[model samples]
Target: MDLIVATSAPSLVLAAGERASIRFLEFFASAIRNPHTRRAYARAAGDFLAWCASAGVASITAVQPLHVAAWIELQTQTLSAPTVKLRLAAIRHLFDWLVTGQIVPHNPAASVRGPSHTAKKGKTPVLDASEARQLLDSIDVSTPIGLRDRALIALMVFSFARVGAALAMRVDDVYVQQRRLWVRLREKGGKAHAMPCHHTLEAYLHDYLDQTGLRDEPKGPLFRTITRGTGQLSKTPLPQANAYAMVRRRAVAAGIDTPIGNHTFRATGITTYLKNGGTLENAAVMANHASTRTTQFYDRRCDDISLDEVERILL
Candidate 1:
């Protein structure tokens, strides 16, 4: 609980020390349930408070809009707009919580506006349909690791699942429903999304489960780390960093020029679907996005159309 200790520092000190500290800790430990968001927000809040302390700010209550704006200005120089915006949000939310608890008189960050940013397309590098097929076909499925990798990649691409949700799956999440293979994903915000598997994904999953005998352990992790030397799957679930590394290695082996990440498959699938007459609303539903606007970021059909138009310039 470094975050707990952070609450007691001079940056957070107020008239009632214990009460203020308790509220600060509760903001992270209780108010935010998502581990990823909790960690990120905690880092942003802690860094901002530490900077304030170094600047000779006596207490959290003394923090003013000027202090917040100055800190944000400095952050803009080094961090991207999105990163700075998220940090600002983290500070705004913490102060709002403190104000509600009577730890502070008002939210200093309330009036501050972060750098404006609007994105119509996501930055995640996507594979063309041919490259995607090549990557999947290039895997040597003789080994259990190969089968697992192929299945995991296909699951993300087909279901439009986030890497976090795909790795969080359990053996039982893949189930037979009405004679078709279906996957249940526990997406962000504790959302449960169930999608019928694409036929290719169905085949890959069947081979992986049957060959590895993971079907017997229905409660075990769906995707697992490999034990070095043994080449056997470990009981622990595959970590996101490890999955990213694996994706990079597979892309290289398949001779893919685009530098792809775990999110690439999701974007690739969405783009392919939309190009093949799929609706944006339907893609949003499948991707579990709260809004179609977020889904539109993953729709990169315009990139292809733009390239086609660019080739029309004849000298």
Candidate 2:
């Protein structure tokens, strides 16, 4: 039907005269089954709109295969191939909707190929038993904050938690029974996982809780920043950036050689378990990976490739 072009500073807003496309977009947003997917789609669409303005494609209908290709080429230099592919898919979706509404004659970039980006295949960092001990020992557990930091490191290592999941735990998420402690994790994609707290984690957590005077509050954050003056700890959950910063700061203090971040615990946990005869499937389940292949990527942490020669030398 009818097309109306509107201008914004960073975006060229193209509207359907009857408000059909806007309504369609709203409906699409509401109809999506998964909120995470819907949010990603919304971000991708927004980025595509900005790209369209930069490319001088005045309207969605005017966008061609070359325009799409040029965008992909531009993205290749700056973003990973997977990200570029996702951007293209987002643009394709908008054109598909335009075609359905008859706002465009055809989906011009319908057959455009996405950027070929492979997953990063790299060695994961690991802390041997000595290094893990050194890292724990680096924390001065005598002070209140130091005690909490020790408990945090022990909990992360034992549970193999993504730091975000660990930080999101509430006091009630931890339970003690029959001399064993357990931590309930709110994992990625809103999945809930229960992991047993090892003896070390239990001891540290016990000391931390007793020292901090955490009560039986089910909703307040489990991990909090300790105030200096009143000795008060905020109930607000720590952000992911803060989680990462904590890990990096501790790594520096411990004088770790390998590049370390919050993920180092996860990688080190998987590698350590595998070296100690734990199976790939078990690690995958422990890490909450959807596939065994994702766990396979962690095998690169082993320095020696010659270990695979076992079959050739077999009797």
Candidate 3:
């Protein structure tokens, strides 16, 4: 096979030689399938190698634990702990691959430790039940775009789906199972998760499909992009960035004060469910989480309780 080096990581090719460069490209092109993760890892690898070159590191094999540690320290000064940690992971994994391929004698980043980060609560901004309702009700469903946006947002909240999983859906993924509306999501790690839709979500989906005449196009994407100059849905799947922008615009239009994103609805739905006396285990199952601990991070009932306690400070 020919050596195919990505232009973004020119330093890797120049420092590591052709054999090592091919292994490096293979790690991203073949090993990492997820586009987002591949892009992040590529950036991390490229940045780290470029820094090494500027620091007078002679070659890729000459990099040591000290070099890795110093790079991480510099990263901590500019990036968040989680981001630094992720970059470290990317570096470590790349070296591990190189070592196994006999490009390097040992993994230099293997012994390096990333910055410590622990969080009981996630930073995703969540909305109250009333705010969520207001946002949904504010959309004018006179056009295909309106119906698409409303259905997409409702799918995330009602199904507790990640934005990626929600956008990955095909029209056939939303279908009748046992005479009730069910959604099938291809979640992280290629996990196939199916859930019966909430009544409100079912109604929104029905209206979206019926009005848009998308029910006949079962193989097409469930959420699609809108064509410019035409108020019609395109065959392309809705990009996550576009969905986020739409959510921000909708929130501002709804008079919501909280700065929310695509993830806000998922967190909001989980919090609302827990507030109404839902069990953690059940919530985990609904959210398709392998552990209740992961689901606990989305439970923002404490936010409401904290607000109530602050009211006790009477003058």
Candidate 4:
């Protein structure tokens, strides 16, 4: 394919040749299907190439293992280990792609090692069950925006859905299945998962849909932006950044002290469910995780600070 991806190609990649530029672009465009991963990998590749240029590395082809190692070592000074690992992975994967395509003789990033990182539990701050309830109850359902926010939050909490999946829903994605509300989520890697709504989620979704008259527009976005002056739901879907800001605002208004984000409810729900006799295998299925190990990260059932244990200190 005679693709012209060089116009937007970085100087380091372009200096290598047309073949290298096309291969570099293809690494992100064709090899990586997930938009989030693609964007991250693109940023990593760009930043590394720019750094290489600044360091007087002539071209992408001239990149060496020492260059990648030094770059990653520099990254460790400011970035977290997991972040440095991901950046290294991006560089490693891109070079591997280039090597396979015959654009380069070797994968220079292959021999480099990233910073070590290991975690028994996730760092995402989870809300207590009462805090989740308080956040939900604090929303003013008198307005469409309020109802939308409540429902969106409830969906993530009760259904164990990622924020990306929750926001990607169409009104039609919520439908009656055997007299109960079911939500269809196209999760990561285009996995289609359908989940029965928790009774509370059902109520919230019903309120948001019926009160906002969103049920009438089955094909439109489920959660949407509010009109500039009208305070009514607009055609545009709510972005992830807006969702984060909204969650923070709602948490503060509800007097929740724990800092939380879009993923907090997901972890909170998983932890709550596990605490309430939910199994790891079942939780994994509900969360659309490929493995129980991944679901285990969200299981914060043991996260409670044991005041009893603390009081045992004689001092």
Clashes of each: 0, 0, 0, 0
Q: Candidate 2 — what's its lDDT?
A: 0.72
Error of 3 at 105 (Å): 0.9
Off by over 4 Å in 4: 1-7, 305-307
**Residue 139 in model 1: shift from native, Å?**
1.4
* Clashing pairs in model 4, backbone N/Cα/C closer than 3 A: none
Order by lDDT, highest first = 4, 1, 3, 2
Q: Over 4 Å off in model 3, which ranges?
A: 1-8
Q: lDDT scores for all predictions?
A: 0.92, 0.72, 0.91, 0.93
TM-score for each prediction?
0.94, 0.77, 0.97, 0.96
- Clashes in predicted model 3: 0
RMSD of each: 2.1, 5.7, 1.4, 1.8
Residues forming the 10-long window of minimal summed lDDT in candidate 3: 1-10
- The TM-score obtained by model 3 is 0.97
lDDT comparing candidate 1 with the true structure: 0.92
Order of the predicted models by TM-score, top scorer first: 3, 4, 1, 2
If both were scored by TM-score, which would come out higher, candidate 1 or candidate 2? Answer: 1
Tens digits of lDDT, candidate 1, 41-130: 988988998898888787888899999999999999999999999999999999999999999999999999999998879999998899
lDDT of 3 by residue, 132-173 (tens): 999999999999999998998999899999999999999999
What ranges in model 1 sit over 4 Å off? 1-16
